[model samples]
Target: MKKKITLSILISEILNLISAPLAHAASLSDVYLPGKALGGSGATIGGFVTPLIQNLALLMTGLTFIILLLSGFKYITSHGNPKGTQQAKDMLTYSLVGLVLSIAAYWITKLAFVAAGLDFLF
Candidate 1:
């Protein structure tokens, strides 16, 4: 029963992640970093900057999730052995570092986007 419930939750989370990008994709093709967004057709420097920032955000988020999965695996394998426990602790610590670094990266990027006068993410 417990295994079934856990499996269901895991499946739901996977489905949600798969569906999110489709839901949030922007429709506009001629973006111009917010300030100069009125210009049409030609690719400007500001135009590339927006896609770069958006992709970086997705990368950071994915990296954080990967770290979390590693930590979860470590925890699961740490059952009755001292060596396993230490390994798990190490993985968890590293995971925490990755998490903090990713959050800092996200905040800094968000600040940069605002400074660049582009649309902000929450």
Candidate 2:
């Protein structure tokens, strides 16, 4: 009974903490408005999505690089263990593939944005 009550109280506190943020949540306009947060006064889908896509691409690239490094380390440390070496090789291959895909995706998005005359967004 005591444990249950404590768990319930903890859950309630968590709910309260989460609700505080929801109560003050920004509206869609506020969120989608380009440069509003940056003290600029323009709102375009390109403006909103370009940065998001770029940032996502950058993040993915960084993560892929880190994965590649870890996988290389694993490969070097495998010490003739076939399974470990294979796993590390797989990781390296997958990370390289992901990095390539992300770069291609970023370029495609950039081309689309340019074709749409939103090149200025970049």
lDDT at position 60, candidate 2: 100
lDDT minimum window of 10 residues, candidate 1? 30-39
Score each candidate by Cα lDDT: 0.70, 0.85
Q: What's the residue-level lDDT of 110 in candidate 2?
A: 86
Task: Put down candidate 2 lDDT per residue, 1-122, tens digits, no spaces.
Answer: 99999999999999999888864675677665655654668578776797899789889988998999999999999998999999999999999999999999888888887887764365
Clashing pairs in 1: none
> Cα miss at 18, model 2 (Å)?
41
Model 2 C-alpha RMSD vs. true structure (Å) is 12.4
Every model: Cα RMSD to truth? 20.2, 12.4
User: Which one wins on TM-score?
Assistant: 2
lDDT measured at residue 93 in model 2 versus the true structure, 0 to 100:
95
Worst 10 residues of 2 by lDDT: 30-39
Query: Compared with the true structure, what per-residue lDDT tens digits does model 1 show for residues 1-122?
Result: 99999999999999999878854553464233332333444655545766776687678778767877886787787786788877777877876787688678777877887898766644
lDDT of 2 at 17: 100
